[model samples]
Target: MQSLDLRRSGAGHAILVRGGRMARLVLSAALLAPLGACGIPYGTGSRVTLSEAPPSAQSTPSEGIMQALTCMRDSHTLNRIRFGIAVHSDGTGKSSYGYEGATGSFLPQGTAAIWASEAVIRAGGLSMNYYELNTERALRQFGGSSLDTALATQQQTRVPNFIISTAFTALDFIGGPSMDIRAGGIGPYYNVRGASLEVSAEMYRPGDRMTMAISSLNRQVFYRDAGIGGGRLFGKGKGELVTGTIGFTDQQRLQEATRDVIALAVADVLASMPVVPDDCRQMVENLKAAHKARVNEDRPQEKPAHGSRARRDDLPAQSPAPRIPAEQGPASGTIANPDKARRNQR
Candidate 1:
């Protein structure tokens, strides 16, 4: 069982007084492909399919899993997801935006936003069921009912210009144990401990739609105090667990379980713009072509005689991708066919 140091500040005792309780939370991805639409929708009872080939092409199950996992690990691609709120003032002033997961405490600007997005996608896809449940659990545990209420209100409040972007990545997983004790009756409870607590996060986006859903469980055991007198105590042993989900509005849609979805969205949007750097587009195109060529080369083909061998000139020489700035958020146009964007990448 995990140990707590209550000697200082009686912190453990205070937590008990604050009314701690065992709870759980759960949360709910990306891509740009142009042969078809590129949005991934998640639900409480949904089954997701991954593909190594564009949606139209068939892939072995293992291939799809590998491709999905690799895409989620790319960090440079991860930075583009963003979340924030646009606030308008009465009469005279201009409108301003405040970011979610943004704070000067414990982390730098955008740190939480970035990490949270990655966490969601990596954990899985964010879904509505997970987001609402997780948020409710957190608020109840931390005495943040007011914030929870405010969030609920915001979901129903309609604003013309609101967008949220999210992605799934590796950092979204965490584990730990939490204990809630009832102490009003029978002397103060002491020496209670838990072991091996773990947590995972998922996120939902604009329109209160699910973005990514992630769930993680860990081993935990709770033990209470045993003794008499002022120091005397009776112990009851029970297990504890927590599950939760988070929702993001505006630019805050990214979650560890949805990074691939976000990236595909951004890539798709950028593909339509005339102003996007040609070099970047060329690079992505080149990558696609090279991948195609590699796939073709690996296919079964009849061996040719030395005298009839085809010249290298028959194959198109692939160009290398040019390095360019990363594109953020959803791109300019709706991706037409997702199959093209879903092309296999090694």
Candidate 2:
């Protein structure tokens, strides 16, 4: 009786152990099931999506200038007009973000001027002596004799017919009141910001030193956003949770707006010029061809020759089938033409 009781107790212990192991296995399986849906491939490799880099900021201005030049070329209104660009200034005389002090150390002096020069050159209707302008200070430092000698040596040192200048006349920034709303434990905050800029430009004939054409442009940019925050019961857990969100305001937008304004001003100023520079037209053609080549290069290559059904039809026709000679054969090499063999035997 004592041995039977001990045996029964051992059996019960084994049963309990088995039940515990089974429960643990089921729990592990439940936990691991979600991992299968994660889409992660087993092994050492990682997944990535490949793409090309974005184009440069200058691309916009360059493309805009190209289009304007194309229009001018088509209409046959382009002519070779010599011109020079001087440093643009903030004529407003008010302190702004970039222009802070009297010395004007913060402002970008040639931003618009350089764009205009490039536009004129790319249009193929204007001429600018970049080499002369670049070397002017150095030549002057060598004295009047050295300057005269340098000018005499140069084959082309023609004076500019007109000088172009630009000025930033106004800048304004406005901000809307920040508003926060809450409903049922959820809250959202909203606000708006705006910036306005004004620019003026003038074209002056060198001979008379008088303004031939004047133009002004005003541009404004705005940014707005609403940020949301809320809390809810997730999986019966009570814990602090934070989620990150992307903002819409990009600082580069301001620079882009400035470039756009410069491009427009350049187009307007060039329109009033008597003749477009000849070199600018050639540059336009070159830029167009380069853009075409770049676009073609980025396009996917043609499919393989065998993969294309259209090319299969374009292939040369195959030659006629070769003729096969007649043959006779047996285990002992019996001849098919037995009559000829019999004649030979006779």
Who wins the lDDT comparison? 2
User: What's the lDDT for all of these models?
Assistant: 0.33, 0.59
TM-score of each: 0.21, 0.51
Each prediction's RMSD over C-alphas, in Å, is 30.1, 34.5
Model 1 is weakest, by summed lDDT over 10 consecutive residues, at 85-94
Candidate number with greatest TM-score: 2
lDDT of 2: 0.59
- In Å, residue 307's CA in model 1 sits off its true spot by 36
Candidate 1 Cα misplacement greater than 4 A, ranges: 1-137, 140-144, 153-270, 273-275, 298-346
**Candidate 2 local lDDT, 1-346, one digit each (tens):** 9999999999999999999999999999999987864666546686544577987663557565667666665555545566677776766554445543445422345455666666556555565643335577666667688676777666356777778777777777767567767675567877787777777778788767987766566666667776775654444467555444333443325545666466556655665543434354334334434433543455675443123222212323432433333432231233666766666567
Off by over 4 Å in 2: 1-58, 62-66, 92-107, 129-135, 140-148, 152-157, 176-178, 230-252, 273-346
